[model samples]
Target: MENGIIYNSNLHFEHQRWKGELAFWKDELKFFNNRLSELVTRWTNKDVLAQLEHYQNEFVLHNEVIEEMLEDIEEHETRIAGQSKTGADALDTQMVKKHLEFRNRLETQRHIYSELKKEFFRFLEKYM
Candidate 1:
C-alpha cells in the first residue's frame, strides 16, 4: 500500500502513512489478516477470541474468493490474447466486468477487515 514498510522512531509519521493507505483502500486484505493475528496474540480476553476466530474464518473465505477471481482474470486475459478481433473484443468486455466484480468484492473484504480491527482494538481497550 505504502509501496514499502518502514521501521524507525518516526511513530507519528508511520501511523499517518498507514492511515493514509487505509483511507485510500490501498492496503492489501492479506496484510489486514496478518495484523489481526498480531492483535489476537496480544489479547488476553477469551470472549474476544470467538469473534477473532469468526474473522479468521471469514478471511479464509475471502482469500479463496480472491484467488478464484484472479484465476478467472488470468484465464480471460489469456483467451483474449489468443482470440480473433471480434472474439477478443467480447472477452475484453467480460474481463473488464470480472475485474470490476473482483475489485468490489475486495473492497467489501477490506471494509470487513477495518471493522474487525476496530472491534478488536475496542475489545482490547475494554478488557486488556
Candidate 2:
C-alpha cells in the first residue's frame, strides 16, 4: 500500500539520521579521548597541581557527555525496534530535543577543552 511505502521511507530517513548522529558522537569522543591522553603525557610538573586537577575534572566531564551520547544511541536503537508510526514520531521529537541539549553541552565542553589546552601550553612555556 502507499501508506506502507511512505512509512518505510520515513523509517529509513530516521535511521539514516540516527546513523549520522552516532558517527558524529563517536568521532567527538575519539577526539576527546586522544586530547586527554596527550594532555596526560605532556603534564610533567608537580608544581602545576591546580591546573592538573582542573584538567582532570574537565576530562571527566567530557567523558560523561560521551557516555550520555552512547546511551542515547542505544535508546534510539531500542525505540526503533518494532515501533508504531505514532511512537516513532514521538521518539523523533524527543530525539531532536535530546540532540539539541547534547550539542549545547558538547559546545561548552569543546570551549573548556580549548581553554585548558591553551593554559597547559602557556604553563609549559613559562616554566619549562
Candidate 3:
C-alpha cells in the first residue's frame, strides 16, 4: 500500500500481502547483512569458505524462488491495472491464474525462509 493510499474500492488483498512480504524481506536483508559480517569476521580461512558455500547455496535457492514470485506479482499487477483501464482479454485471465499460482509459491517461500532462519541460528549456536 502506498503511504497515502486509503482502504477504498481499489484496495486488494494481494496488495496487502505483497506489502507485508516486502517489509519482511527488508528486515531479512538487514539481519543477513549483520550476521554474515559477524560470521566472516570470526571464521578461519577454510571454515569461512565452507560457510560461504553453505550460505551461497541457501541464498541462491531463496533468491531464485523469490525473484520468480516477484516477477509474477509484477506481471499480475500490471495486468490488473491495464485491464481496469482498458478491459481484460484472454491473456488477462491467464495472468490472474498465474498470479494465484505464484502467490502460493510465495507463501511456500515464506515458510522456507523461516526454516532457513532456524538453521542459521542453529549453525551459530553450534559453530560460533
Q: Which candidate is the best by lDDT?
A: 3
lDDT of 2 by residue, 20-81 (tens): 65566557556655655665677676756556566567656756665666576556556555
Clashing pairs in 2: none
Kindly state the number of residue pairs that clash in model 2: 0
Q: Whose TM-score is greatest here?
A: 3
Query: How many clashing pairs does model 1 include?
Result: 0
lDDT of each: 0.55, 0.57, 0.65
Of the candidates numbered 1 and 2, which has the greater lDDT value?
2
TM-score of 3: 0.70
lDDT string for model 1 (1-128, tens) is 13332112232243344345444443355665776677688777776777667767766765665556455545644554565444432333454455457557657766876786686568556644
Ranking by lDDT: 3, 2, 1
Could you report the Cα RMSD, in angstroms, for every candidate shown? 12.5, 6.4, 6.2
Cα miss at 73, model 1 (Å)? 0.6
Q: Alpha-carbon error at 76 in model 3, in Å? A: 0.8
TM-score per prediction, in order, is 0.49, 0.46, 0.70
**lDDT tens readout by residue for model 3, 52-102:** 568757866776666666676666666666766664333334554565576
* Ten contiguous residues minimizing lDDT sum, candidate 1: 1-10
